[model samples]
Target: MALVTTTEMFKKAYDGGYAIGAFNVNNMEIVQGITEACKEENSPVILQVSKGARSYASHTYLMKLVEAAVMDCPDIPIALHLDHGPDFETCKSCIDGGFTSVMIDASSRPFEENIEITKQVVDYAHKYGVVVEAELGTLAGIEDDVVVSAEDSSYTRPEEVEEFVRRTGCDSLAIAIGTSHGAFKFKPGTKPQLRFDVLRECEKKLPGFPIVLHGASSVPQEYVHMINTYGGAMKDAIGVPEDQLREAARSAVCKINIDSDLRLAMTGSVRKHLVECPADFDPRQYLKPARANIKELVRHKIVNVLGCSGKAL
Candidate 1:
């Protein structure tokens, strides 16, 4: 029950023909909810810590929480990952601080600069036996403090992926394939589509290499309704369709990022419980159900979206 790097997970996922769910972890309850679901499903999971996560929950607390998860679920294959590490210093710090996997997100910088930064991170991370994941194209949407509007988002050119992989020597590539960031990714009257053609082209160029999809959460309408019906106002909040995510997983895309759905699930339950039971003032009375809802949501993602149930040791 030790933490592992994404390299091993991606290799196994690439061979198994199913992607592992890389869920974002912000706090103790979120970590417990996700890892507990993983134990139930017998699926390997990645507990990704973003910059905001580190800031919100102190790095020491988050690390200790994951360590507690390892102790709690001794059989699950869990990896502590740094999601979207902005620069070499951040990536290096996470690697030094016990993160097994770190993503060098320089997609916002110039292409050559991005490569240079990613290369630097790779050199540093490899020294610590930490795996590095890099992004090729920019993803549009707001994730915590990072914000990229729709006009700025660009698809990853298939021609550049091969070169990016060669030049940077990143372990995995997180590519933008029409899946934007945030819950309200697509507008009310539009259907969200992942560019399978681009994925096919990348697979053609770099066979057997693991690919990653960001902002792939399918915002379940049931949760949305619960949130709205129970005093929350997330109207028309939609996400990438499950079929689209399933298609990616069946292909070379092996890591799917999901956060908003879990947030929605937890908030929906908490709001409902708060609205229906105004007399219940205890924090646990509300938080317990919220945690349970998040667990159910994670289990559903493993069984339905990722199809990774029973794969863990």
Candidate 2:
């Protein structure tokens, strides 16, 4: 089939008590690994591209890579999305460039300004048959070009969601509940808990509407250990507990964003492969394992965490 919008996927996820995985894609290996897993698991996926990813890998290359994935995995539904779009121009470019969905993240701005900016993008995107996702609260930590400190981050106000959605006309809303960007989501020696109270309130307000959670990667400690064993020193790299994410999926959270996990899986695999086989200088030799690791990680996520496995069929 062709690339689809998140509308139908989110609807199914909401009804099925699951969430669609929105994985970030920057290169061919990443795209291939994610799609292959989704295809095997029979789960729909949202392959998203960020502004920084567009800068690192040209937009055209990413588009063609996704296009190829569509051809390679024709059975499952796939949505090409612009993740964390900074402005209307970026969102417009993706909407016009064949992306099925786009996210306009204006959460850092004042509420009124955020609504205005999101509305502008929503107006333009809906005209092109593209769906728009908007963020209501800023997330902490670093993800590509998105950087917000812990102190600056705030939980999404449940009260503001109704008006924001009404005014912006976005297809989905990303809320910051405790999930932060990157691997170091919480400080060491602290229990990371998502504010389900806040989430519940939002659900009460926006019933039957699709909600999204950014910075939702559960940074598997196995990957962290693998990286450290292979000459890396990433300490205290904790993420949202898988159980908490599973609970959210059973609620109104219809989409969950995961990027750090993919990066950790690939980086750790490449590090281990190169360190063990120093004589192997070929790119494929190292990236082959990295790609496999990513595929396994995605598969685990589909079946265990997101609970969307076999939904595509």
Best by lDDT: 2
> What lDDT does the true structure give each of the candidates?
0.90, 0.95
Candidate 1 clashes between residue pairs 3 or more apart in a chain or in different chains: none
Q: Residue 227, candidate 2: how far off, in angstroms?
A: 0.4
How far does residue 174 in candidate 1 sit from its true spot (Å)? Answer: 0.3
For model 2, the stretches where C-alpha displacement exceeds 4 angstroms are none
Number of backbone collisions per candidate: 0, 0
Q: TM-score for model 2?
A: 0.99
**Model 2, CA-based lDDT:** 0.95
Model 1, span 108-192: residue lDDT tens: 8989999999999998989889888999888888888669998998999899889899999899999998987788889999978
Model 1, stretches more than 4 Å misplaced?
none
